[model samples]
Target: MQVVLRKLGRGSRAVVGRLVRAPRKGSVIVIEFSDGMHEYVTTPVKRVLRLAGREVFYIETVNSRYRLEVRGREVALDGAVGG
Candidate 1:
């Protein structure tokens, strides 16, 4: 008998995009990034992940979970609604 194995793509469940954290404002920091086409936003955030050298970061909030993928300077983020 022969068995078949499937391969998984690099696609993730979280929203994938490019986003960078701002220089910090007051008591919070801002995330300014490109949506693969455009840039936007500034909000209070709680950092929960930071792994250098080809790794993904995951941050969880009261209502959402954010996954950040880093590649040198180029980065990717995944946002899951409703945590």
Candidate 2:
């Protein structure tokens, strides 16, 4: 999916974007930004198993942490700026 990091919040922040490729259960999708930053969010098949049949799936990421959800993806920047 293509998303723009508009505002960064302290806790769980909402990511606004268009579902370019409707994510599937257990599917690991890549989120790319305008500034060339990318990150992968892996959906637990069990968590999204029900939504697997749907065309789009929205997932959430851990907040207030600076750990790279995965490798190769750029680390998210502090404040409201794309990494």
Q: Which candidate number would show the highest lDDT if scored against the true structure?
A: 1
User: Local error of candidate 2 at 82, Å?
Assistant: 32
Q: Show where candidate 2 strays beyond 4 Å.
A: 1-10, 17-20, 47-83
Local distance difference test, each candidate: 0.35, 0.32
Instruction: Give me the candidate number with maximum TM-score.
Output: 1
Q: Candidate 2 residues 22-43, lDDT tens each?
A: 3333444345544456554444
In model 1, the runs with Cα more than 4 Å from the true position are: 1-17, 22-37, 40-43, 51-54, 72-83
TM-score of 2: 0.33
Query: What tens-digit string does per-residue lDDT give for candidate 1 at 1-83?
Result: 01111112354343333444421212222333334455333234444554554355455433344544444443233231112
Question: RMSD (Cα, Å) of candidate 1?
Answer: 12.3
